[model samples]
Target: MSYASIGKRLLGLAAIGLLTAGLSGPAFAQKTIKIGNVEPLSGPSASVGVQGKQAREMAVEEINKNGGIKSLGGAKLELVYADSKSDPTVGVTETERLINTEKVQLMTGCWNSAVTYPATQVAERYGVPFVVPVAVRDTITERGFKYVFRIAAKDSWWVRDQFRFLKDMQDETGVKLKTMALVFENGDWGTGFAEKWRALAKKDGYELVLDEPYPSTASDLTPVVTKLKAANPDIVMLVSNAADAILITNTMAEMKVKPKVTVASGGGHADPKFLENAGKNALYLFDEVEWNTDVNKPGAKETNAAFKAKYGYDLTGESVDAYVAMYVIADALERAASTDPEKVRAALAATKLSTGPAMICSYDSIEFDESGQNKNAGIVIVQVADVNGQLDRVTVWPKNARRAGYTPVFPANK
Candidate 1:
């Protein structure tokens, strides 16, 4: 072979080798950012948690499709989920694992407050930013943790929305309000809920008829039902999780002691599966939610459709909020110029971002006061409207209710 030909062949070989390495770059060299989660995967709250996972995955999927987090310089997202199984200890253990083993810098959250309370403490101890999506209890933030930030409004917001709706119900229906009976499951979510509801009942000039907390694992609440029925209140409300909501509704059906209205405060619509299972019995069942963009002014339908197309299901607030929250965190991470705990906290505190279904001010200016609570947050009010396949979920009260937020009915002082 000619010397010139040999030189050309060697040059071609070198070019080919360089091209191969460049082509294999992302597969071998891309950075992976791990985001941790501990949520119910096997218990009654599983539906809610699963939906959140789906939504978060969908968001990460979409973002990755668009070249991933800008600051990560194309690093892909990795979500590590620990099925908490609706247990607090499991949640704590998962948090520890995520922090120590996985070395994840951020966490989404567990859906149940029982799970969230303990999991949040772990985040506090580790100084990881936990972006809470749907769990309510104000205590999550009351502990003064710097790393904990709840985009989802707390229980106080929902309780307040319920009061506003109750007042409106009286004004609209002309039903003179008299008695209120509060029922809830025995858990963190239930504990905070019952306390807030009782306080509201006192402030609203309503006689407290039945105030009770039943075991969350109770198979049959017939005994609780009997006592609540005996009170004979003009109105009844449950501040329990999804399972209890279904059970209470079923028991109410069995006892045939229908009150003027039955409401499920915050835990009412956590899962679409439960809502579907509740069936006709769930009709007129009022629920307070932290996010739902149905009544949103604009862009909500597009975002909801995008999520539906990605996940192959109708998106609820739980999923939508988490998906948006990921973006919120990502945005803040970019804005603050660093993911350091303190810097991230400061950016989150100064967040005035907006999302698709931000009826609860998820899109408004997000500034946490010293208490770490977003002041401009709102909630969505959803009423199960199925009268045996005749009607679907309907929004009756606030013509423009966006956040399913609770209107104030408590702490007459506030």
Candidate 2:
């Protein structure tokens, strides 16, 4: 070949070499997979939102520390956050921004059911995978959306277990509960629980002395408490957000509106701030949760201890769900071996995560049903009691999972 021809051929070969290197470089270089999180970090539900954010941060740190997404060239998971302020409209807009602007591959959160309901719809419209950690409205997963997956038990399941616990405790303690009062925040989450509570109470032949719904952002719940006092219910069931929970609990104590049994449907009741703010007034209050500090699962205590050390408070049920969600996302990305939304969705759909750090959940396995709901998700009832001289949430129901030496104080008001 002539010198000119040889030079041209060499140039072509060099071009091909550069193209190949460009293709293979990304395969070797560390990459980041952005997971968008839309949470209520500013408004009424800020406490729960902050808890979820912290939990996700802790989980991502652990995953990165342990070698992130080994299937994706050790790509680390990066959480991108947008504060929904517990508003549905803000949640929808933030989700769009995360997907279109931030280029996140997956999505999670918006703790309030009002926010999560519409937020998941936006994710569904975009064909992005959304993993919901603890929005308990039943209809969230019931919309036939393939991209949405929830890790916590829905409100119906929560209500079912609440009634079951009441029956089981009644059977064990031989103290009957007849009239029930249903007081919940006027939101998607609270209304969902109230609907189920009504159906279950009627079926169980319990009279509903009061059915009241108040705004979560109400500056004063004294009126609600006063109504509850007048109702004089044997069992008082409450569904509230953080601020409202504290207000109602303290107001009840101030008014001395003690019922035979007071039950709370997690949410604000499970918030650490509620216990801290309500103090002894919240004692003997039965609340439903996905997991507790004293749970029987492996890694439960250690993980909670680590979280408490880091955040200055123990992990709540809402936070634990968010923590486990990171592991589930990592597991999905590992199985999918790619960051493609469809691949990640498929992997999430086929997930059967029964082991690893995520097993700290009360359920043995994490599997999604046709509706994208965690089929094995379970709930537990815990009573706020004095443990070691400090108010602590002690698991009490399900007989088998009750704390080793603590018997629940049923009929809290005698």
Candidate 3:
């Protein structure tokens, strides 16, 4: 046979095998659920996607080991993922593939807000019950789509809180940060963050000395760093994901243009690479994030420890968010007691969630109010400091010594 024919034959055999396993007997029929994942498995945010993918699969394994979703009579989870390539247009197409071709009952993911916005549109078109774990664009939930649900806090929630905390620092520490400089990538996520910061800085009585938005593909940010240095602001805040975050930090240090502190608003710096990339300069670089398993307590403590033991490294906002997202998806499936999309929608809409590191979680139950946004969830800010050259999250709010407040999580600060 020709090589093409042989390849086709192998593909046919694999399909047959999958079908046989799925159908084999009535027992299997009673317990099978397909989940579709849309994440940036390639491109600038690929590292974030890979981490999320690992955590999600691990969550499914744990759930299945415990007999899957009991409400669905031990319905096993089958996950299907596609790379969004970090492109919004591609996201829409991937969503169609998962829904039309894969025929998934429930869907989750698309980490970047830009990708999430367009992909969720696809979910609503097909009437699929979509649960978003990590996307944080304000507009994602603002559209009022009934079938879409966000279990994570929007970017607005976190950025707004960070501004409030900055004001708080000025009041408490007597650090009158007069001139402020802003540096961010020119993308949907970066644009959203820059506009919010601009408005808030002016409103809060800080001089917006400089604002520069770079393209995501900028070969080097030295020119941007030079502009920021000449402007000489009290603080410089950066907003970008993964590789870009490290690149900016490295340039800032190389140019010897360290502000009082460089605050970054993304989980990008929460990874080990931040320290590994910038060495000593990584210290005092602030970051605002969703959840930290290091602060895990009670149930979360055990879960985080188990995760570290299993994964051979620590977890980040991406990993933690994906892990919990998996459980929430399972919970929704269990509550629905059926894989029918309509029933799953009802279950997800009626969900009330409580998870590890309860302090960082939402007190309110899972319910999309109008815009399909999480009723609970909030963002947390961190100052990365090296303790003997290892990066760690240093608390900046409630004095870093105090950890109680009226702030929210799940859909935090709102």
Candidate 4:
């Protein structure tokens, strides 16, 4: 069936779920629960932020159409948006405005880790529940804030898995990788990943050929790529945003800097536009992500098809997390049965969601720990390849999760 039809079918199933849940009263339309969303709507990170926004809109539409909040007489969720412009100061102000002015009952977003770090602080201070979907900076959940909950794997986990994938691939291919390079955008997210990469590289006994961090907004990444070429490490690890991701990939290709292995941490690298713009340049690059279109989950393909039908692009890891965050919020609200902040916070803390649309994630379940981190959160590695003449991401690590019939090119340079 076509993706559009599949999306329609999913909506039909959601309606069935609503009926099963005993949703019946038209009075539910009388109340609308406001969810504050702070995002980088028009800045360097805007592309990713907009992707998150679209994903949330899709989830919210499904929920409202099906039943709204059944326990609250089916009250629909209304998203209130504030553009952070990828600025921390703007994030802080927008978050406060959403709470005090817009009067949102709960909150989400500010995809940039730097913005999310402080914006979540504002949510915690005001006692509003903030459900983070994609910001991976470990510190976001480590601050002991009761109101902040993260749905994605932390940067530490991401880094850990990156190294694991590298090791597993080496073992399987009999390729001995010795030297490594770390190149990332100089941001909270990138810096955080770099810190972990440094320790892991040392622990694994790999030589550090080069370590460089560049501005995400830099117009020219040729200098960094030049350094990378000179260092010529066996493996090159990167952390970049959308625009810079394209620039770096193209620049590396242009400069003929082909490392034995090129790995990306999935910010801009996972963006659909990254694939479109980077094209063949991104071929054979490995990226760590929470979800992929080819993931083994049941509903993943249909959901991605629907999202692509609507948005004209496949869902990225960032968008998938944002999509799941809405369901998490809905589940909490369903249990809480009220917009009361404390009750919602409590319900969120007790989340053990294992079914429904949210299960479309690569992981089997969603549950938070004491730190408000999703303890069940996991990551997967995918390589860019040509499937049926289309450049696409194919899951290629962890043995079982690897896409069938496709052998990965470990060292594409040779």
lDDT of 2 at 210: 98
Alpha carbon lDDT of each predicted model:
0.73, 0.93, 0.75, 0.93
Using lDDT as the yardstick, the better of models 1 and 4 is: 4
Question: Which portions of model 4 miss their true places by more than 4 Å?
Answer: 1-29
Write the residue-wise lDDT of candidate 3 on 1-414 in tens digits. Answer: 899999999999999998887677554465578889998898878878878888888889888888988987687898899999888999889899999998888788888888898889889989998888888878887887878888777878777887877777667655567778988877777888888998888888888888999976678888898998899888787887778788888887898886765677875676656667777767666677766654534565676677778876666766777877777788878888888888988888877766423233423344556676766675666666554555666555535532344121111101
Question: For residues 225-275, could you state the per-residue lDDT of candidate 1 as single tens digits?
Answer: 899879988778787666777787788778876777677775545456656
> Over all chains combined, what TM-score does candidate 4 have?
0.93
How do the predictions measure up, each by TM-score? Answer: 0.84, 0.92, 0.89, 0.93
- What alpha-carbon RMSD in Å does predicted model 4 have with respect to the real structure? 9.4
Candidate 3: segments with Cα more than 4 A from true spot: 1-30, 355-368, 400-414
Q: Candidate 3's error at 299, in angstroms?
A: 2.3
Better of 2 and 3 by TM-score: 2
lDDT of 1: 0.73
**Model 1 / residue 186 / CA error / Å:** 0.7
Span of 10 residues, lowest total lDDT, candidate 1: 405-414
Please report how far candidate 1 places residue 88 from its true position, in Å.
Answer: 1.1
